[model samples]
Target chain A: MTSYSLILRTAARFLLPLLLMFSIFLLLRGHDLPGGGFIAGLVASCAFVVYLFAFDVAPVRRMLRLDPRSMVGVGLLLAALSGVPAVFFGEAFFTGLWLELELPRIGEIKLSTPLVFDIGVYLVVLGSVMAIVMALAEGEE
Target chain B: MSLMWSTEGAGLLEWVIIAAFALMCLSLGLATLRLLLGPTLADRVVALELMASITVGIIAVYTISSGVSDFLDVAVVLALTAFLAAVGFARYLEKRGHGDD
Candidate 1:
């Protein structure tokens, strides 16, 4: 078990949510900007790693609420499924599709198949990295 | 790159940015030296953190010099990683019974 440090614990408590939010921001702005799913996933994993450093594996596992390996499987499924919708439209696999919607309060929203693919990538990266890190940390104990 | 060297249209702000870049490079070199020569693990980790921070500074400076905001995201990611690296090192040191140091 890792020894507790008051300062590190406090900082990790605040940083985890902020880092997660930034990762989402990176994921969302990735299409037209210099952000993307891969980097965002890394950032998110870093957030959890920070939490793990301050606390322990058990709490971190509880917070996650699912096995990291399962996350990788679900992410892979989502990535494959994201391309299936294009096949329904008579397009080849992995073809980009877009839908634009206007909601009353939210104004305009542009949805795309690429976004789904990015989310899948994010999940895969986050899951695999966390699983590896968690295993290593637990082994250290 | 050419903009930094060209004296034709350089302003005070550009000169300051160039100076900032020079200072950052100098500090980066010093940090690298410390990382190579530090006697203790903690010193090496601190040096590494310093190098990470200087890299972030370089990115920020480059962003200002080039008038592109996109690179700021890279800086943000770098900073986050650096923070994690520092925390991880601290945890390792504590585990090894060197936390007081």
Candidate 2:
């Protein structure tokens, strides 16, 4: 693949972080909202895909020090572990669990096991999707 | 098509959705035509990309009309994979001597 114009590179540099942050936000709110881990991970991976298009795969690989396959493994582990917590609690597997915490200046924040599961899903999706992207971007370039 | 009229709120939102669906259909038809008739591999790839985007739009319209937000996740996934497929195919073409011209 050929390098894109300077304008695209510059724009992508500015856009990548925003896209990543948005994906995380999506993941955080996914249980109650339209967003989720799978979609968030896909969205985050697209940021890298755009970066790969404008620049190349080398920088992206360097940025992502961990291998994509490892990311998938870690994600699956997190998701599985999320379910295991319920098993230890003697609840049925994959049960929806929540925790309420009060923080200074921000009032109460609710956290849950499903969000952990979503994060795992997010990582899995990101890793798998980026694996495909890395294969394509690195091939014959 | 019938559901578009049958769903409640048959006012401006319904007409807007109908118009959006009509536009999506037209674009899908054009993309399919290009996919079939394009002389070059790049042209077909581009047509395929356009069709993917159109399909995403259709998914969004369906989500809106049905009042089910779950389908939006499907649309998001579609949009994400669509970009990946385009890049992969473009690379394949490059390896086949297209040279990314």
**Interface Cα RMSD per model, in Å?**
1.1, 2.2
Q: List model 2 lDDT by residue over B1-101, tens digit each.
A: 45656668757787798899998999899999999998888999999999999999999899888878778867866776786688667656755875333
lDDT of 2 at A85: 73
- Clashing pairs counted in every model: 0, 0
Which parts of model 1 have CA positions greater than 4 angstroms off?
A: B1-10, B98-101
Instruction: Pick the TM-score winner.
Output: 1
Give per-model TM-scores. Answer: 0.92, 0.76
Two-chain DockQ for each candidate model: 0.79, 0.40
TM-score of chain A of 2: 0.94
Q: Write the per-residue lDDT of candidate 2 for residues A30-106, one digit (tens) a residue.
A: 87778889879978998888788778888998888989999999999999988877887789999978899999999
Give the DockQ of candidate 2: 0.40
Residue pairs clashing, model 1: none
lDDT of 1 by residue, A6-74 (tens): 998999899999999999999999999977889999999999999998888889999988899999998
